[model samples]
Target: MEKRMIHLDETDLAILELLQEDARITNVALANQLKMAPSAMLERVRKLEEKGVVKGYSAAIDPLAVNRELLVFIFIKTKDSFANDKSARALAAIPQVMEVHHIAGDDCYLVKARLSGPMELMEMKRSKFSKIPNIISMRTTIVLETVKESSHISIEK
Candidate 1:
């Protein structure tokens, strides 16, 4: 199948900005804000999804409220030969992992993980992660505080 690029106009961009702020906003409310009919607004949103502009929606959970005790950024350098789908899949299966980014330069992958405490993080390193074959090295940095985190994407239209 061939993929087509759909260009978004200013109105579409505005709609996206509003939705990013609150994904659960009702279609009628969004239409009122954008000054368009609800049916038209819904069609635009459906088109955005079809074109893969709006991938999906998710709730932003407060980590503190859920007793999340730690946030760690792990840099992993794997053996060049071992960097493949097998290794990536192995890392993804670990429950503590929140995000995995394939990086350039010295490190092969960077992983963001949330855990209960230092002890749990250490146990994960020794038991689950270390068992993965051909892992060259793993470096971890615990987050002291989050300065800024925004899901909003800047759109120029």
Candidate 2:
């Protein structure tokens, strides 16, 4: 895939840093911090959104509280060639599957999934994964502990 570069200035970087720190920060508050007028701040943020710099805002939920204590990374080998993303799309369609990446190496895809427990994982393997076409094999690795997990990206000048 081809990459596109979007130009960003110091103000844009500042806005990104603040937004990354707290997405819930109000437009008025964000403007105040940077000493920018609320309307100006809004315009800049909107332009960033238009450029695809700011994807979207979302809340971070606790996995344990939602009965999704088990986190697993499943490496999948598919029968399809590199040009095909059908298997990857199918895996991503599963609600339990949080992320699916078309990968390099022996495996065709890397899937990050959240499940209740071992029994749930087994059930998913049998009921869910078995239905996806072209999936030849799957090797799952369960995460015991997560020391650091964040989606934040630092914006440097």
Q: State the lDDT at 69 in candidate 2.
A: 98
Residue 78 lDDT, candidate 2, scale 0-100: 96
Compared to the true structure, candidate 1 yields what TM-score? Answer: 0.90
lDDT of candidate 2 over 10-108, digit per residue (tens)? 999999999998999999999999999999999999999999999999999999999999999999999998888889888989889999988889999
**Tens digits of per-residue lDDT for model 1, 73-143:** 99998875633656667888999898888788788889988888899899999998988896789889999
**Going through the candidates in order, what is the number of backbone clashes in each?**
0, 0
Worst 10 residues of 1 by lDDT: 80-89
- Least accurate stretch of 10 residues (summed lDDT) in model 2? 148-157
Q: What is the lDDT of candidate 1?
A: 0.87
Local error of candidate 2 at 100, Å? Answer: 0.5
Query: Candidate 1 has which clashing residue pairs, if any?
Result: none
